[model samples]
Target chain A: MIALEVKKMKKNFGGVKAVDGLSLKFEKGQITSLIGPNGAGKSTMVNLMTAMYPPDAGKMIVHGVTLEKWKSYNMPTYGVTRTFQDVRLFEQMSVLDNVLVVLTERGVFRSLFETHGELHLKQAEEILKRVDLWKKRDEKAEDLSYGQRKLLEIGRAVAMDADIYFFDEPFAGLFKEMVKTVVSILHELKNNGKTILLIEHNMDLIRELSDHVIVVDAGKFFAEGEASDVLARKDVVEAYLGE
Target chain B: MDYIMHLSVLVGVYAILGLSLNLVVGYSGLLSLAHAAFYGVGAYGSAILMKDFGFSFLSAVVLSVLITMAVGVLIGLVLSKFDGDYYALASLGFSVIAFGVFLNWRDLTNGAFGIFGIPKPEIFGYKFLAGEPYAFLVLLAVIFTFLICYFVVNSSFGRVLKAIREDEKALQVFGYKTTLYKLAVFVISAGLAGFAGTLYGSYISFIDPGGFDDLVSVNLIVVVILGGLASLNGSLLGAAFFVLLPELLRFVGMPDSITGQMRQMIYGLGLIALMMYRPQGILGKFRL
Candidate 1:
């Protein structure tokens, strides 16, 4: 089943077309890796789909709900959430709070009356343990190391419990053990039948993890298919492989 | 004894002001200089309601706080569009505008003549006319404000404010309408500041446009920063220093003419030194 579909999306920054007339499909329960060279608009596509930046023109159909315009603040309510290319966590907040906040009461009336209780703490801890961050649950996010910050960001996204998770470079920099932890988390998420869209450069990891690959060049589609088939394309090699 | 009671009441009122500003500057991370404007609105609103309409103390205060909140929301909507230094400047402009209104809107505010003969707070049938009794009342207000700040900051709603301060876009992606959150804090802060204003107006039994201006707003901001950004106790500590330091200087025997100028200079130097040595302020956890 299709989780999200993008049709004729166009976005431009100044004179540059970041994402130009791009049409794409994200399937449910599948890990789709978006691969491209530098400035291939991989991240821009995520921005447009997530409504971080409004597309000059586009249509996003999520679970058959057609949306001509997507408001960035409505994503979580729509059951969509994303992680940043640069890990963005509440720096001053405790590691546990970073996750608990996502699960906390969101409505103003309820927020004032309700507090973070045992259920919220238990869930936050579970997500933290999944990322092996339960030990540092009380530490501020800014004090975490580079790799830990990435894990925390992932942990926060996991805490959101959103249906569609767009991870922008979740595995860019990490130790082998941390990478394994993330790989396991993603595998578990996939096993749970969650839709995952990842933007990554590591071909080996892409081959190992991705169920499908979509290649883009200069803000336009280059090729897309099964990992083996798309990665074998001559144009994809010329554009992305720097051949 | 009366002198000390009066001084303590001043501290209590300023402490309430500090806590109110801290909610915006410390917890929510918005540097707002327009706090005293809301403070003034509360004072003037209560003063007018009670003096002209013969309203009870409780009714007047509640109405003034509500009026201040309405104004706060209007200003917050505009301030929400700007961030960082721009946000500060826009707020400063609002403070200036509010001051202008207070100074020139004579028909309501009474302008330079100021409002006087404001009655003491009377609840039920008992009138709180004594200095110690009023001081106790002010202390109660301080405790109430502190408790509200404590619970709100510790809640998840407060966590989201910190998140917005860190990365607004990221919070929005998580489906948080940052504008509403910002506005909420702004209105709450304003309402509390208005409460403090009412306390001040009732305590002093008089108020003027001069009491709420750029200098007063800057003084409140200074108290928030010095006590420490994002620290509730820092607000109390800041209020202590802000309210008492000048009073202490009055006894230094320096001429009153130069004393005012000298005290301001000292405050500037102290702030500069604090920034150099402890940019985080005395107990600040976060730095602007």
Candidate 2:
């Protein structure tokens, strides 16, 4: 079944159309990759999906309701979670606190006086262990190596229990081992029937990891279908690999 | 001997001030320019109550703290909508309004003539009035408040605040409503600032609108930044310097005319230099 459907989505910055009549379906339990050249509006699409930016005209159905109609805090209702192009972790907080932050139950007044419960702490510990960051959990997030910070953020997302995971350039700047850590996590996620939409420039990774692919060039979908076929297209190659 | 006692009490007062401001400015990364307003609120809230209602010191102090904090929460709700220098401006507006209250609320606040004769705090059978005995009480309260801050900053709740400071969006992705956290921190900080004001009022037995000006707010900022943002120990050191430096001006042999202006200039200059030399502050090893 379609887990997320974008119907005639359009976003504009002043006169510039960042997302122009974009329409796509993300299925539950499939790994989908949105690939495009630089400035191809990949990040903009992610932002629109996350409700960070509202489309000028569009409808997004997440888990059956139009996400646009829901409040900003309920974006997670779509079971969606995402990361930034640049890693954003609480700088002064210990690495463990990063994941623990996500694990805490949030409400307006209750969470303020509420401390992290045992379950939350357990969940954070479990995720950190998976990311191999349990050892460094006491260290500040900013003190981590580039690779570890990315892993920590990924761990935080993992603890969020989002059904539809939007990973924005999850493998960017990661070392080979860290990339494997991420890939393995994705594999585990897909095996458990979690929907994932990945934004990536690495064609090789897209071909290997994605079950489906869509190519956008200059704010419009230039190509779609099997990753192998799309990567071989003249337009896709021309946009990324150059003439 | 009296000067030494005053120095310690002053240190205790500003230390509480610095710590309260630290909750917002340091940990939460909110540049609050209206802290002095809340500080004023606490002072005036108690002042008016004690002066007109003839309330005892204990009741007046409690009422003042609550009233100031209530005002603080309202301002926090509004300030929560803004950040960076914009948040600063919002706080600045609150400070200005508080000043207006101090000036225009004539019958209650004595119309800028100020509130005097604020009785010493009477708790149980013990009394905290002038002299070393009162200084000890201030010291105890300051220690208690600072300990609370230290614990809060080290707790998971405080980490969430720091996270919001680092990247508000990051907190959202992890499924947090950062606006709520920011407002919570603001209210807490404001309440502590009000508590400081209550102590100030009871100690000095006098207060007026002039004390809660924008410059006072700036001075608190100077203290935090100098101590270093997000560092509790650094804030204490900064508070000590801020409260005692004016007293030290006597030793420096500067003329009385230049004393106030020169001390303020030094505070401003010192903050700038610290931000330049060690943007992290004296003990802030982490960058937010």
Candidate 3:
């Protein structure tokens, strides 16, 4: 089932076509890797779909809701969440608080009176333990190492429990252990039927993890197919190799 | 004892102001200089209603807070459109505008001469004239304000505010309306500041536009930053330090002719030294 459908999404930044009339389908319960050259509009496409940037002319169908323009604040309500490429964690909050903030009730009035309940703490602890951040839960997020910051961000996204997840370079700068932790988390999320859209440049990991792959070059759709088949395409090699 | 009570009342008033400003500047990461504007609104609102309409002190305070909240929402909406330095500039503009109104509107605020014969606070037929009794009233106000601040900064709402402070765009991706949270804090913080303003005006039994000037607003920000951002206890400590430091200068035995100037110099040097040594502030986990 298509969890997200982008129809002719177009975005331009001052004569540079960041995402130009590109339409694609992201399937439910599957991991889809969106690969592209530097400045190939992969991140732009994610921004457009998540409503971070206004599409020059495009629309998206998310969670059965037809949106002519993507609205960033509406993403979570529609069961969609994304992690930033530059790790954006609540720097002053405790590591536990970083995840707990996302897990707490979203309602304004309810949140005002409600403390982090036992269930919320349990959920936060479970996610933190999964990311191996439970021990550092009392430390500030800024005190974490670069790799740990990335893990905490993923942990935050996990706590959101959104049906659709967008991971932007989650494995970048991570150590092998951290990478394995993230990969396992991604697999676990996929097994639970959460749709994952990853923007990554690691060709080997892309081929290994993505069930399907969407490739873009210079803001245009270059290729789309099963992961291995698309990676083997002559055009895909030339696009990456700059031949 | 009388002198200590007088100093305590002043410290309590500034503490309320510090904690209130800390909410907007520290937790929400909004540099709002217009807090003094709301503070002025409360002072003038209660003064006008009580003096002209014969309203009770408590009713006047409640009405003034409501008035400040309304004004805060309007200004907050406009300020929310901008971030970082721009937000600060826009809020400062509002503060200036509020000050201008207080200064120019002679009929309501008595203009430059200021409101005279402002009524003293009375509850249940007992008048809080002065001395320890009045100081206790101010202390009660401080306690009430602190409790409210504690409950808010500890809740999920506060967690979101801190999240908003960290990265509003990231919070937006999580489906939180960052603007609404910012605006809510603006209104809440402003209303609390206004409450403090009411207490200040009644305590002094006089008020003028000069008291709510940009310097006072800057001092409020200094309290938050000096004690620490995002720390309620820091607000109290900051306020005490700011209020008491000047008084301590009185004991330095400097000549009365240059005592004020010497005190200002010492205060400036001390702040610079503290910032150079501990940039995060005395107990701050965050910096503005």
Most accurate candidate by lDDT: 1
DockQ, 0 to 1 scale, candidate 2:
0.54
Clashes of 2: 0
lDDT of 1 by residue, B1-288 (tens): 998898999899999999999989988888898998999999999999999999999999999999999999999999988889999999999999999999899999999888998989999977887489998999899999999999888777788888888778878888788888899999999999999999899889999999999889999988998999889999999999987887788887777678778878888998999899987689899877
Q: What is the TM-score of each candidate against the true structure?
A: 0.97, 0.94, 0.96
Worst 10 residues of 2 chain B by lDDT: B279-288
Clash pairs, candidate 2, are none
Better of 1 and 2 by TM-score: 1
Clashing pairs in 1: none
User: What overall lDDT, based on C-alpha atoms, would model 2 receive against the true structure?
Assistant: 0.82
Docking class of 2: medium
lDDT (Cα, 0-100) at B108 in candidate 3? 85
Question: How far off is residue A24 in model 3, in Å?
Answer: 1.3
When just chain B is superposed on the true chain B, each candidate scores a TM-score of: 0.97, 0.96, 0.96
lDDT of 2 by residue, A184-208 (tens): 9999999999999999888789989
DockQ of each: 0.75, 0.54, 0.82
Runs with alpha carbons beyond 4 Å of true place in candidate 3: A241-243, B256-264
What lDDT, from 0 to 1, does candidate 1 have? Answer: 0.90
